[model samples]
Target chain A: MSRTRVQHFSISLDGFGTGEGLSRQAPFGHAGERLHAWMFATRFGKTMFGQQGGTSGVDDAILSTFAVGIGAEIMGSNKFGYPGWHENKDWTGWWGANPPFHTPVFVMTQHKRAPLELEGGTVFHFTDAPPADVLAMAREAAGGRDVRIGGGVRILRAFLKERLIDHMHLVQVPILLGRGVRLWDGLEGLEQVFDIETTASSSGVTHLMFARKGG
Target chain B: MSRTRVQHFSISLDGFGTGEGLSRQAPFGHAGERLHAWMFATRFGKTMFGQQGGTSGVDDAILSTFAVGIGAEIMGSNKFGYPGWHENKDWTGWWGANPPFHTPVFVMTQHKRAPLELEGGTVFHFTDAPPADVLAMAREAAGGRDVRIGGGVRILRAFLKERLIDHMHLVQVPILLGRGVRLWDGLEGLEQVFDIETTASSSGVTHLMFARKGG
Candidate 1:
């Protein structure tokens, strides 16, 4: 059984997973854009945008870990698009022309959309299938590499609830929305254990890596 | 024009700005619960639960800032008690006999719910009127002291969208829900200029005070 890893997910100072001051147009809100400013300012970020001459720092190192060279990525509907979870097959990935998930990306959605082909092998497979199934396909697509669970929050919950997550790398940034959406609710006590593997960063953003104590 | 402070909000890495996870229930989502934990772990927190002998730290200090010798506080209808945007008037404060806001706390709502006097000076008012109207009520209630806008999201959005918030304080904690609801979504062109005032902590949590550059 292959394991799933959640990497580089950042949060506002207020504990929101995402979507604090969000709308259909902005989606991530003002603060959320700030949460990831550090990510896109690095060498790895430049590579994603087809730019050159970027610096390598804590941000670069972290973003580089999420590259196609490292793992396969998975996401939920919310991360893929907007609200109105009703059937809308026309919804495309947020990134215009070329999305960052150039590798095979698995999206979790009840409404199925055709596999979207873009620059690189970024074939977005939308499935109404269960998280386990999506993850399984993602693992296969990853080809023995680690699978990164990209999120909008719901997808992360599904895996966490089932204890399917192996390593979680959280990049907590400094900024609070106070209210919007949150990362921790309901799933409190269920024998979920994670051991801190590392807490490293150069920017104000702190990266925390936690894995099963023994696994 | 009296300035309104939108305190303690959350956000995610992608800027989705919402926490509403389907399986996730009540008051945002996973991140919503994280936002509450800081207050819940404070001495003022114990005071709210009719207990005592709680520890003090940045979290406690922030809580004390609101609990002891405070000015006034405000909460949206969702945080006050009522779930989502229901026109019903049965809901009151989330706290049972006593709520954390010991001073006068204003409630933002559309439907009118008869103000029920709690054990403390905490008062819940229904202002379906407008954001500015509620702000006026809150300022008047504060007399000459500062007013804290305790929020869920929408209420914060009203002020944030209107650019009415002055000082914004966010407590960044480490935890992930993966998905429930979000905080900083849909807020575009917020044009907020902030000054990082103070920083300190307890319980691995950091307390950051951002005074809107002008205010």
Candidate 2:
């Protein structure tokens, strides 16, 4: 069975999961961008982004997991990298024309925007549905694969509140934005146990995979 | 004579920032929020956030610098942490009624919003202003008091590109989101020199600082 899993999420040492203000120009801001620098230069990203001469090695081995086992993806509107509801809504998002996730994507948004259709088998579904509704949707879309509880912050916490997560994968980079949009803002209670797997990248990013207790 | 100096910022050996999905619930998420766990409980942050009864000592000293000598502040719209532009033109940002910064705040944005007046001596100015313009604003506002270039990656990079930043404070946390956003996207061509200052918090986050060359 596919329990809930939060795959490949990074956190900052300042106890902030993400740097504040993820905007178009600086999605990750200051040290925020350094978190994923390793992945971009990796063979996986280069190949996906259609760049030539990408390096291959252990890093590539790690990069391989980025797309391997996974069913559907979930994220907040900001996580989708799109801001605001426009009249036309023609913006295909910041990923140029094609985005990496080519499957059904569940986007969390409060407003009412039509679902987005993309070239590479990607469809954006906007929902004001509850976390449970979204998760249920993701699981069905997964088709017995796995669910990626992708996100901004609030979306992820929605699932974590009920312990609906199964696995978490993150790449922690060596940088810090003292304070901005910190990962931990309102979580003062609730406890968790994480089985962690870690590795340091050549560019100095640390990759980790976490699994919740007992499936 | 500005030397490259890194300060106050912290990170982890594994590079996971506090945690992914910085929302009100899990806050730092799992081991993620643990990034800044050491600071909020310290003296400086307590004072800044206006709380009482925090532990003081080594951690307080460290926390102080994150706020100390901060003559001015720089941030992008994202760093502002307001819900969305749809809210209203007069948004004062996430810092409570009275914000932490008592100086001029330079906000970089595409849309020009009206300047926000805050409870304390804080005024928010929006400009499609280039990084140079923003820095000029910050420096002018700084009045020789040494400005703190605060932000997510894009704002920082824009400043870095112009070589206008004087000192950078970073905290490296050990939490990784394999893919979400990376900090160095536009870092390819920017020129920067690193002078490192290392400090460790109880939560295992590493603090770093940088002062650019030739301020």
Candidate 3:
């Protein structure tokens, strides 16, 4: 029974997951990592960048669960690379030679490509299939463990709309990204199916955890 | 030196202050009392209804400040009365003989009407003045005390767009209204002028407090 989960997803106060004007140079566009600055200040976020001395508070505790009991990851094309990265066959990913995901990573895109095996047991599986097909593939690849939805907002919203997500954690940063890719659009009355719990940290970000009811 | 403040204003997680289809029967429309239900569970809200025994924790402590240091109040027409309420001349307001507000209340509306004085010190004065003019009038009526911006979202958004609000405290309810009057629209980059603080109560509502810098 592998659960589908979305972890450590950050959004602005105005519900934007990533800012507008995204490019190769500015991955998050004008957002400039502000949405995830809180996580960066946490112990887990610091360890990701090979840094030290971060807070071990609520943020750190929750963010540390990113790698817990997970086997495979499914990410959107936007998160895999910038606009038109599929055209350039050389584009492996934003992550260097050895990516953090030490498992089979499925990139949901219309353009299919050969599975590129990277260091640290990470393999990129590009697929043109829909969510259910991708989920099934990811689940099989995950063995008996859970599958993570590594998103850039659009993919997360699509999964949420289809009721494919089991557990979701959204970190709400306290900044107004006036223009960006919104997360809450079209997913109205989401509380009907999920139980939402809100917790605020001293570092100024609010964690909204949503668990599917009776799942 | 009276400061313009907005206190205890509740909005849904999706940013809707009030739901659609407003009428005399359902003041908040589809939203009903869900947004203010947390406040009602507080000691201050219980005391308002002449009841006793309610939570006096963070929610109560913060809600108890709704009337602190306020002289006069300014609100939108939507908050004053339901749509087409002006057609019925006898209609005073949603609140009965003795309204909650005990200050000289200024109702911003296009329709001009004579002053309607209710029980206690609450007097309804209808005016079509803009945000600045209404603030000046409310300030004058407030004397040396602070003036509160009692909103239904539209008026508050107007005042916020004009940057006339000195302090604002918004309670974000967990429920998603889906559709209604939104609070955050057109007022982008608001954080540049106001410093925001967030606190979550045990009753499952997040309080967002914004104070203008150097005001």
Q: Return the top candidate by lDDT.
A: 3
The models' CA-based lDDT, in order, is 0.65, 0.62, 0.91
TM-score of each: 0.55, 0.51, 0.97
Give the per-residue lDDT digits (tens) of candidate 1, residues A110-168.
77767889886688887888888888888899888778888866677778788888887
Model 3 lDDT per residue over B1-215, tens place = 68999999999887889998999899999999998999889899999999999998999999899888999999999998989998989989988999999999999999889999999989999999888999899999998999999997999999999999999999999887878888877766898889888998878899999999988
| Cα error, candidate 2, residue A140 (Å) | 0.7
lDDT of 3 at A215: 87
Give the best candidate by DockQ: 3
The DockQ value obtained for model 2 is: 0.03
TM-score of 3: 0.97
Worst 10 residues of 3 chain A by lDDT: A179-188
Q: DockQ of all candidates, in order?
A: 0.06, 0.03, 0.70
Error of 3 at A117 (Å): 1.3
Q: Write the per-residue lDDT of candidate 2 for residues B1-215, one digit (tens) a residue.
A: 21222245433333333334544344333545455656787777677767887877767776676645566777777667532642565456767778877777878877677777788788887888777777777777777666666655556666666666567666654443432223443333232354434444454444554544444
Q: After superposition, how far is residue A180 of candidate 3 from its true place, in Å?
A: 1.5
Which ranges in model 1 have alpha carbons more than 4 Å from their true place?
A1-165, A170-210, B1-3, B7-35, B67-70, B83-102, B113-126, B171-181, B189-210
Better of 2 and 3 by DockQ: 3
Worst 10 residues of 2 chain B by lDDT: B1-10
Docking class of 3: medium
